[model samples]
Each structure stands twice: as C-alpha cells, then as structure tokens.
Target: MVLAAACTALGLWQLDRRDQAAATVSTVQANYDREPIAYDPSLFDTYEESREWMPVEMTGTYDSANQRIVRNRPLNGRPGYEVLVPLRLQDGTAVVINRGWLPIGNREAGHPDEVPQAPEGEVTVTARIRPGEPVLNRSAPEGQLASIDLAGYGAQLDYPMHAAAYGLLASESPAPATTPVAPAKPAIDLGPHLSYSMQWFAFGVLLFVGFGYAVRQQYRLDHEDELDAPAPVRTRRRPSSEEEEDAILDARGL
Candidate 1:
C-alpha cells in the first residue's frame, strides 16, 4: 500500500506539471495572436513578467557608441553574439534592443570581426518585449556582457533605461539592408510533460496490480498441502439391544 501511494503521489505531481505547461503554452499563443500595442516606457517603469513577449512599436535613434554585446548566443547550431544597443528616446531615456546574432571569426589569427553598425537616423522599430536576463558570473571582452541585465547596462551607461529588452522584429530604416536579422519567435512547444504524466500514472497502476497478485499467490502457497491431502476413512457401528430383541421375536414367529 505504501509503495502504491508513493507512485500515485508522483503521478499527481507529474499531472500538475503537465497542466502548468499547458497553461504557459496557451498564454504564449495568446500573446502572439493579439495585435501589437504602442510601447510607452513609463508603463514599464516597474517591470512585469506578464508584459514579456508583448509586441510593441517605437521610434528612436540608436546610440552606436555605447553599444554592448551579449556573448555566446547560438542560432541554427552556430555560435554567435547578440548585439545590445541602447536606443535613445526623445525624452533622454534608453531601451536595450537585441539587434540579432553575429558570427564569431577565427580566434587563433586574432581576426578582428567587424560588428555591423546601427542605422544613422531615427528608425521605427517593431519588436517584442522580452524580460531582462539575469547576470551570469562570467568574464567577457570590454563592452560585452554575459546576459541581458538591464540594470547592469543602465549602470554602465550612467543613464535611465527601460526595464525590459526589446527583441527586434522588423524596422523601417533608410538603409533597409543595414538592419540586423531578427531573432526567431519564442517556441511554444508543450514539451514532454504530458507523456511523463501518463507514464507516472501507468507506474502507479502497475504497483497496485503487482501487489495484489503477489498477495494471492502467497495465500495459495500457504494452503497448498491441506488442499492436496486425502480424505479420512469411516467405519460402520452395531445396533442397540432393543432393536436386536425385536428382530429375534419376529424370527421365532411369536
């Protein structure tokens, strides 16, 4: 019983995980389905995770001189860097834009890989808001970071910055060709949680069935000798004296 209960508890835990994953996938789908809203920096003065992946549009000039790079971003199995450039708004506040990935050149030759420059003038950007990533404890080249840490970058820039990073989707720039390739949309795969739940439930059922079968077999074994033993023999008994006297009188014809 204890083993069965444990298996059942595990199955319930998996089921809960499955439900949570489904809900997350549903939320992601809904976020993409809705039309984009105009981005207002003040609306995100206090960061909210729910706002992540919300499509937004804004027009700003790129601060090319204060650009930063996020090291080691991989796309299509090729390692690269994500260019993080601050887009200066008219109000003097800045927001980090993840331009996209850039391939690494051969390191042995000390090859100076050139980073493509952002456009010269104000450009209207259509992008999805992404939550700022946590800072990892790793070293990189100067003007490069380990992840998207908005507060960290704000400190580095010595200026106010939006709390979230905007992932570039499309831009209307004078030099269309200068735009960096946009990152792919976030994945909405439901993952293996559902299958894991089913497996756990199967294990719980098997435990109960196996335990019952083992108990029945043990009981049958304990009574095996008694079941196979032979039956006891019986003997005939003599009649009473009154019955014998009656029988003799009848035989004498008196």
Candidate 2:
C-alpha cells in the first residue's frame, strides 16, 4: 500500500510538470502562426515564451567590427558558422542579429575571414521570430575565443547590449545558389515529460500485481498440508508401558 501511494504521488507530480510543459509549447505555437506585433525588443530581454515567433522589424546600424562566428554550424548538411552581429537600432537600442550562416573554409585558410559584412548606418532589417541561442553540448571554455556565451560575447566586444543572445536577421535568408538552410529558432520541444508520466504509472501497476501474487502463494502454501489430514485428538497422548504399570500399582494402593 505504501509503495502504491508513493508511486501515485510521483505520478501526480509528473502530471503537473507535463501540464506546464504543454502550456508553454502551446503558447509558442500560437505566437508563431500569428502576425507580428510592434513590441519593443526589450520585451524579449528575458526570452519569454509569449514573444516567440513574433515577427519583429528593427531599423539599425550593425556593428561589424565585433562580429562573432558561431562555429560548428550546419547549413544543408554543410559545416558552417552563424554570423552574429550586433545591431544598434535607430532609437539607440542594441539587439543581436543572427545574419545567417557562412560556410567554413578549408584548413588552408582556416575559418573564413571573408564572410559578408553588415553595412554601417541605419539599415532596416526583418528578423523572423526566435528566442535565444541553442545550448551547445560542448561550448567554449570561459574567456576563450572559439565560441562564447551571450553575456560574455557582449563583454568580449565591449558591447552596450540589450536582451537575448542571438537573433537570425531578416536580410540573411539562404539563396537557391547556396546551401539550403533554415533560420534558427528557440528549442521548443515539450512532449517528453508527458511520456515519462505514462511510464511511471505503468511501473506502479506492475508493482501492485507482483505483490498480490506473492501473498496468494503464501496463503496456498500454509493450507497445503492440511487438505488430507484428520483432526487431532484434543486429549493428551496415552502413557508408555512403564507408566501404565506405575498407574496400576498406584490404583491398588501399593
């Protein structure tokens, strides 16, 4: 019973997590398929789910001097780097733009140094809706230049930045002549928690069923020896030969 209760409590806890995850996914989906809202990019400084897929337009001058190359990127199965440049909007707010991908060159030239340059001055650009950078499995070591965290990226470049780590810029869509690629978006998968809840519930049932079999086996074994036996005498057992003689002499008062 205790085991069953504990399992049930755990199942309930997982269910709660499942619900929260579903709601988050739903909110993102709704935001994605809808039209753009003229919201300040500040709303996404913290990467809220509601702001996901909200198509945003910002007119800004890009800072190309401090551009970053997101290494180990993939574009249509080709190895590449995601060009990251900071955009200072007309109103003086900074937002990071993921200006699409750049195919990494052969080791002869090392990483490509001839990636497209973001023009200076106010350049109006559109960014398809997205959230922060993907969590890389093996990111660069602290303060190392290979690949850096968003905050550290800003710090390394001496940036006066605002909100989120990455944004795929509108002007950088893949062309037919180049490797096919899709723009980056926040990681939004949320079904695994619900699947886990089901597994826990199934395990709880198996525990109850196995315990019942054990109890039934014990009961059957306890009663097995009695099926063919007669009832035992309630009185004490009869005396042996010497005891009987003693009893007879005592009866004659010897």
Candidate 3:
C-alpha cells in the first residue's frame, strides 16, 4: 500500500507538470494568433498577465546614451547578454526594449570594446509585451542587471517608466546593422510529461497488483503448510498377556 501511494503521488506530480506545459503551449499559440496592436502606455496601467506576449508596435527614440545589459542571458549555448535601451515614447514616458542577445565571447581578458549599439534616431519597434523580471538576491554592477527589473532600472535612470510592461524586440525599422536575433517563441510541443504521467499511474497499478499477488501467494503457502503438516499420533493402552492371566488367577482364588 505504501509503495502504491508513493507511485500515485509521483503520477500526480507528473500530471501537474503536464498541465502546466499544456497551458504554456496554449498561451504561446494564442499570443501568436493575435494581431499586432499599437503599444499604448495607457493600457499598461491596467495590464493583465494574459496580455503578456501580446504583439505591440511603437514609435520611439532609443535612449542610446543610457544603455543596460541584462547579464547572463545565454543564446544557443553561448554565454551572452541582452541589450536593454529605454525608448522615449511620444508621451514623454519611457519603456525598456530588450534588443535581444549578443554573445559574450571568452571575456577572460574583458568584454569587447565595441558594444552592439542600437540604431539611432526615431524608429518603429515591433515587439511583444513582457513583464518585469522578478527580483533576486544578487546585486548588479551599474548598467548591468541580473534580470530585466524595469522598475528597478527606472529608479536608477531618475525617470518615471511605464511600470506595467516592457517590450521584447521582434523587429524594428532601420534595424541596427548588428542587431541580435529576436526572441523566438517557446516550443509548443506538449512534452513527454503526459506520457510520463500515464506511466507513473501504470506503475502504481502494477505495484498494487503485485502486492496483492504476493499476499495471495503467502496465504496459499500457509494453507499448503497446514495441509502437509503431520497429524497427531493416536495412543492405545492394552494389557499384556501376563497381566491378564494374573487377573484371572486372582479372581479364581477369591
């Protein structure tokens, strides 16, 4: 029973993982299907989690003077960083744009002197809305961050930022000659998790069945022992011939 319960718990865990993966796939698909919309800063104030990954377009000027690097973002198994430059929107408020990843080649000697710079001048950016990254324990060097915590970045920039949303650059006009590749959509494949869940459940069933068989075999063995056990020996008491003769002589003498 204990073994079966453990297997069942594992099955449930796998099932939960499967569900989470499916939800992610569905969300990605939905985001891909929706038409690109204008990125209105006004809408960000009421942004919902569901709106994440929504395609958006905006016209803004990159604040090339003040750039940041989202550190430790790897690309294609290569150590890399993401360039984040604030875009000054028409409304005067700024939104951070993740310009994508650039490989950090064996920087044992120090990073490249020539950074991949964003295109200058007014540009139209086609991107997906993304939330600020969660905070972590590590502190970052100035102009470099562990994650894209836009609010934290905004605080450093001494400006009020579009608090609710940031952009992942899908493409831009007059794109930078050395622009990094755009962030790709996550693979939509519902992984082997579902099958794994089923396998776990099967294991649980098999464990229960095997346990029952073992108990049955033990019971059968005990029954067989009883059937093969030796029976109690019968005891009989009979007088010897001499004793019988003595008894008859005594009766005759009396």
Best-fitting candidate, scored by lDDT: 3
What candidate 2 gets wrong by more than 4 Å, as runs, is 1-6, 39-41, 44-46, 71-81, 101-122, 128-148, 164-166, 170-180, 184-195, 227-254
Which residue pairs clash in candidate 3? none
Candidate 1 total steric clashes:
0
Model 1, 1-254: lDDT tens digits are 67767867887887788777777677678776578788787544655556666777777888899998788788889877788888888888877878777777676321127677888789877666677778889877778888887878888877788865555554545545554556676678777866786787788789878888999899889999987899888987897899899999999996
Tens digit per residue, CA lDDT, model 2, 38-67: 537565477766665666766667787777
In model 1, which runs have C-alpha deviations exceeding 4 angstroms? 108-114, 175-180, 220-224, 227-254
Better of 2 and 3 by lDDT: 3
Local distance difference test values of all predictions, in order: 0.74, 0.66, 0.80
Question: Using TM-score as the measure, which candidate wins?
Answer: 3
Candidate 1 clashing pairs?
Answer: none
Q: Residue-wise lDDT of candidate 3 within 1-254, one digit each (tens)?
A: 78778888998998899888888787788886588898777655555766778888889899988898777887778777788899888888888888887777565332433467888899998888877777777976666888887667888776667767788888889877887766677787888988888888899899878888999999989899787889999998898999899999999995
C-alpha RMSD of candidate 3 = 7.4
